[model samples]
Target: MNKVKLAEGVYYVGAVDWNLRDFHGYNTPGGVTYNAYLIVDEKVCLIDNVKAPFAGELIERISEIIDPAKIDYVVTNHVEPDHSGSLPVIMAKAPNAKVVLTEQGKSGIMKHYQTNYDFMIVKEGDVLALGRNKLHFLPLPMVHWPDSMATYLDGEQILFSNDAFGQHVCSSMRFDDEVDIDQVIYEAAKYYANILMPFGKLITKALGKTGQLPVRMIAPSHGVVWRKYIPQILAKYEEWSSGLTKDKVIIVYDTMWGSTDQMARRILDGVAAAGVTAKLYKMSVSTRSEIIAEILEAKAILIGSSTINNGMLPTVGGLLLYLKGLRPMNKLGAGFGAYGWGGGAQQNMEELLKAAGVAVQPGLAIKWVPDAAELDRCFQFGLEFGKSVLAANK
Candidate 1:
C-alpha cells in the first residue's frame, strides 16, 4: 500500500503481510500488517517499521511523502522483530536522525542488531518536542515484552500503542470504521487470547496507569487503526484483563476408535439441553490456537482424550501444555476419556488443568468403548457441569 494520511500531519506508511499463514505457533489465517506511522512537522518523525523483508516497501511509501534522509527522528515503541527488524536499514538511510527508545528497548535493539547506534532513551512521562506536536512516552513493561512502551501525541491525542490493541488481520482498510466491525472484533479477541492472555495482570495495570489520557485514536502496530471505537476496544481490554468470562462451555477432545467422539457428542447434547451454549472441537482436526480463542471467554472447559499405553493422546497432551503456558484465568474445567485396560488420560488432564490454575472437578473415565449406559452417564455429567457453570456465572 501507499502512504495513507491519518490526520493533517500523520500518515500510515506500513506494509501488509497478506500471505503470512502462521505466527510462531499461533495460526494467522487472516495474515497481518506491520503498521508504522510517519508524522510530518518541522521535525519529521517516524514511529516503528515493517519486518526486514518489507523494509524497502516502507521506505518507498515514505519517499512518496518526503525523502527518508530528511527524517529527523525515529522512535521504536517495541523491539519485536516484526516492528524493529528494519531499524538497521532505516537508521542507515536516515543517518542524521536520532533513534529514540526506552532503556530496555535500547538493550533489546543492541541484542538483536550488531550495529552500534546511539539512542536517546526516554521513560514514563518523558516528552519529546517535535515542533507543534509533542510525543509523550509511557513505559508499559511486560504488557507483552519488557521493552514495550506507548507513544502519545499531545496535539492529535493519538496513542501509538505497539502491540496492546493489535489484531492479526490483513486488509486494504486502514481504520476501524472502514472494515467489518464483527470481523475486527473477532480477530482482536483472538489476538488477545493467543498473544496477551498470559499477561492479563500487567495489561490491567497498564490500562490503569494510562486510563486518564485523552485518547482519540489508538494507532497500533498491527491490523486497522482505531478511531471510531476507541472506548469499545478499551472496554474489551479492561474486561478481558479482569478475568471476566461468559456463560458458555468449550468441549475439546481427541478420540480414538470413535468411542471418545461418541462421549463428546452425547455430552454436547446434554449441555444444550440444559440451556447452555457449548462448542465442540476435535483436537485432531482443530488448531490449538483457535481452541485457545474459544476458551478465552468460556466459563467452563471440558477436555477429553483416549488412553494409549496408559497415557493420553499426544495431541491432547500438547494442547494441555500450550494452554498451561497461556494460563487462561477464571475457568472451571473437567476431563473425560475412554481407556482399554488402564484409565489414566482423564486423571492426567485433570491434574494439568489444576496446575494451570483452573478450578477442576472430578473427571469421568470409562473403560473400553462406552456402552449406552456409559453414554447416558456422560450426558448427566455434562448437564451437571453446565448447571455449575450457570451457578458460577450468576
Candidate 2:
C-alpha cells in the first residue's frame, strides 16, 4: 500500500497479492498478485501495467511519484492480460507515451486491443536511450508465451523480469528481504511448478543470458522485488530450472464410494514403511492446480480412481487429461483404482501418466474392496514406488 523507493528515483509501483481469490479456476492455496513497475528517468518509463481493476490505483501511484505527463515510455515485457490489461487505460492517460515491446510483443498487443497504435519494436539486445539510462530488450519466447521478453535498465542495473523469478505472495513490504525468506522460496517454487515448469529449459537459457547482464535489482510482474537477494533467488531459479526435485510421493485420487481413498491411505502406509515422505490429496476436494504444484516438487506422483461404467472416474480422467497436456518435468508415476464390474481405469490412468512424461510403474486394480492381502500388496507396491522415486532422484 505504501510506495517504497528501491533506488534513487526508482520505486516499486506494483500491487501486492492481497486477497486474490482464484487463478485460472485453480484455488490459490497461496493467494496471487499482479505486479507492475514504474521506472523514473529523464524519460519516465512504466514496465508492464497492472490488472484492469487496479488501473486507477496505479495511475494514482504514478501521479504521486511524478507528473503523469512526464512519462515518456511504456515497456511491455509480456502481453498476458494480467500484466497488460490496463495498457489501454494507462496509454490514454500518458497521451505522449510511446509503447515499447518486441516485434512479437507488438503483434500481441495489436491482437489483444485490436487498435493500431504507434509503437516501437525492439529485437533482442536492441537498446533505447532514456537520457541517463539505456533499456535493453531480450526476447524470451515460450518462457510461458511467444510474446514475452525481459528488459534490462542500464546504469540502474535492474532487470524488469516480466514473470520469471516471480512468486504468488502478498505482503505489506515489497522486497524479498522484507518477507520471510523460507515462505517466499516455497511460494516461488510453487509458482514455477504451476506456471513455469513446462518452460524449465527455456528458463535455464534465459537465466544464462541474464547472468551475462549486470543486474543489481530483479523486478518481476507477480511478486516481491528482488533487490538485495538477487543472487540467492537467481541460484534458486537455476536449481528449479535444472529439473531438480525431492524424494517425495504424491497420491492423487478420486473415488465415488471411498474405495479408492482407502487404497490411497494404504499406499501411504507402504510409502512410510519405505521411509519416504508421502502426501495424500483427494481429487474431489483438492484443486488440480495445487496437485500439479505439489507434483512439481515431487519425485513420484501416484494416481488412483474408481471406475464408472467401465471408464475412469470423471474427475480423475479430467485431471489426467490436464496433466498430459501440461507435460510437467522430472517425476515418476504409478496408478491404481477400484472397480465394481469390469474396468481398466487404473491402467488407463497409468498410460495417461506415462504419456504425460511420467515414468510409471505397474498399476494395481481391485474388484470391490481391498482384502487384507490386497491392502498388504498395495503397501508393498507403495514401498516399491517410493524406492523407484528415490532412485530416479539419484
Please name the candidate that would achieve the greatest TM-score relative to the true structure: 1
Q: Which parts of model 1 have CA positions greater than 4 angstroms off? A: none
Tens digits of lDDT, candidate 2, 36-155: 777787779888988888888888888889877788888998898889988888888888888898888898999999977669888887998887888899989999899899999888
Give the 10-residue window scoring lowest on summed lDDT in candidate 1. Answer: 1-10
lDDT of each: 0.91, 0.84
Candidate whose lDDT is highest: 1
Q: In candidate 1, what are the lDDT values of residues 1-394, reduced to their tens digit?
A: 4558998899999999999989988899999899999999989999999899999999999989999999988999999999998998898889998889989999889889976686899998899999999999988988889999999998998999989899999888899999998789888999999999999999999998778799889999999999998889999999899899998999999988989999999999888888899999999889888889889999999999999877899999999988888899999999998999888897789888988789998878888888989999999999998888999988
Cα RMSD of all models vs. native, in order, equals 1.0, 1.6
